[model samples]
Target: MKVIAFGASTSSSSINKALATYTANLIEGADVQVLDIANYNVPMFSEDTEKEIGQAEGAQAFLRDLSEADAFVISFAEHNGHYPAAYKNLFDWATRIDRSVFGEKPAVYLATSPGPGGAQTVLGAAVGSAPYFGGNVKASVSVPSFYENFDLDTGKVKNEEIASQLKEAVSALN
Candidate 1:
């Protein structure tokens, strides 16, 4: 399977990105591509900007990347209980180019943070709204207290229970 994985964030040292990468790699033998939203270079979405610049190259490239994926693993980084501004902007631009941004591909949604709530609010929103954007959501997982549960040096989940949950979630793609 060609799986696309990315954190819904632009932070260079994003914990959500780490979680997404680790989760996507668990799918045995799958070809995985990890993307960084920061590299897209998409401007904030606005009617005026769209009218002025037409389709953004970054948005188009992002859509093209998504089009190649048979499945997806996305980890959301919540800011104030919702999607990060940068991700939302890229998404907004991509949606304008193609409303069905996810292309009906099976996906596993994840969210994580340094605190106990685990960014569950944004994960819930993503799960609820995915179908509208042509996403076939297979599972959703939230990792709480990211620093405590994940080992940064090894890029692995330290907690056995959470690791098992991540494995089960990825298995849903099959």
Candidate 2:
């Protein structure tokens, strides 16, 4: 099976990114593609832009990636208890190009943060919106107090209980 993984945040040191990458690595015998949304550089979605220029090069490339993936792993990073601006922008543009970007693909939705909430608010919103984009959420996990619960450099879960829970959740996707 093929799996594509990415975090919703653009930050270079994103804990959510680490969590997604770690989860992707856990899947056995699966081809993995890691995406950085910052690399896409999509402009904010607007009907005017779409009518005039059509989809941007970045959006088209991202759409192609989505089309190629058999499964998706997304780790959301909360900003003000909601989705980050950059990720939301890319998602908006992708949906405009194809409202169902996920195309009924199975997805593992994850979230991580330094605080106790662990981006759960954004994760909840994503879970609600995922179906609209053709995503079938197979599993979801929230990694709270990420820095305390995980080792950043090694991508190891420090809390065994949380680790087991996350493993179980990702296993469901497989």
The candidate maximizing TM-score is 1
Model 1 accuracy (lDDT, Cα): 0.96
- Per-residue alpha-carbon lDDT of model 1 for 109-143, expressed as tens digits? 99999999999999999999998999899999999
lDDT of 2 by residue, 23-120 (tens): 88788888989999889977677889878788887888888998998898899999998899998888888888899988898899999899998889
TM-score for each candidate, following the candidate numbering: 0.99, 0.96
Q: Please list the C-alpha lDDT of all candidates, in the order they appear.
A: 0.96, 0.88
Please count the clashing residue pairs in each candidate, in the order shown: 0, 0
Candidate 2: where is the Cα deviation over 4 Å? none
